[model samples]
Target: MDGKRFQNYEAYFTILDTGEKPITQEWLVSLIENHENNLQYAPDVWREYIKK
Candidate 1:
């Protein structure tokens, strides 16, 4: 993954585990939108993963 995208995932994981703060849906959407071109899987894949 690109550095920016990796950082975004890391931030999300960190927040998820630590309860430092909630990761906003808008921020997650923005991160995916920003890295859409670089993603190996489509956004639907991520949505499915999140649903699980």
Candidate 2:
């Protein structure tokens, strides 16, 4: 992932492991929306991760 653009997003993973915050359905939806919005700038980057 692009570090500068997605630094806080790394917290998504930690939320589950650390239980510091809950990952809500709305947050997941926002994450997908953010990625979709970024597709114009980085389709290849999106495809690379989506394929995995």
Candidate 3:
């Protein structure tokens, strides 16, 4: 992973614990590519992410 995506992964993992569904690398890539900025403050919108 590049620096930005790696940062995102770290930020995401820092904020949320793993749920019933795993947060796999593929999903994180989709999220980073599609909605990178949206998740900077993920605590407010983590549920929306899980659905995607």
Candidate 4:
């Protein structure tokens, strides 16, 4: 993993114990990276990121 995603994963295990807070950018980015690494990055994707 790249440094940014690696840091995010680290924080996920250690610091981000409670997922009650609003999602961090690192987490969001990591999710996208996991789902679709081939896609181009775009800030607009965040507009509908958390729909359940």
Candidate 5:
């Protein structure tokens, strides 16, 4: 994964686990829509994690 993706992953996991200023579903949806292609190329771990 790229450094930017790793950083996003770190930030997402941190917010997910700590429940501190968690991301909103709307924002998440927007991100997905904006990065659909990038996400398709992302690791399986990310795909499965998002499915949860």
Candidate 6:
């Protein structure tokens, strides 16, 4: 995966785990939708992760 893309995902995950601030589901969905084609790995990865 590209460094920048990984950074974005990591940042989001960090926010979720820390719970310092809530991230909306729509915002998370939008992030994945915007980068669905540009990031590495198949879309199934995102689908599976988000589905959890």
Point to the candidate with the largest lDDT: 3
Give the alpha carbon lDDT tens digit for every residue of 1-52 in model 4: 4545533343343233333446456556856676564223423334345332
The residue-level lDDT of candidate 6 at 15 comes to 18
Error of 1 at 50 (Å): 20
- Cα RMSD for candidates in order: 14.9, 16.8, 11.3, 13.3, 14.8, 14.9
TM-score of each: 0.27, 0.27, 0.30, 0.25, 0.32, 0.25
Across 1-52, the per-residue lDDT of candidate 2 in tens digits comes to 6556643443333112323444455545656787555444443433456567
How close to the true structure is residue 1 of candidate 2, measured as C-alpha lDDT?
Answer: 64
- TM-score of candidate 1 relative to the true fold: 0.27
**Top TM-score: which candidate number?**
5
| Cα distance off (Å), candidate 1, residue 35 | 2.8
- Name every residue pair that clashes in candidate 2: none
Q: Give the lDDT of residue 7 in candidate 3.
A: 35
Residue 42 CA displacement from its true place in model 2, Å = 22
Off by over 4 Å in 3: 1-13, 36-45, 48-52
Q: After superposition, how far is residue 40 of candidate 1 from its true place, in Å?
A: 22
Assess the local accuracy of residue 39 in candidate 1 as a C-alpha lDDT between 0 and 100: 33
Clashing pairs in 4: none
Residue 16 of model 3 has an lDDT of 66
The 10-residue segment of model 4 with minimum total lDDT is 38-47
lDDT (tens digit, per residue) of candidate 5 on 1-52: 4545433333333323423444446545656676655564444555567788
**TM accuracy, model 4:** 0.25
Better of 1 and 5 by TM-score: 5
Clashing pairs in model 3, backbone N/Cα/C closer than 3 A: none
By TM-score, rank the candidates, best first.
5, 3, 1, 2, 6, 4
Ranking by lDDT: 3, 5, 1, 2, 6, 4
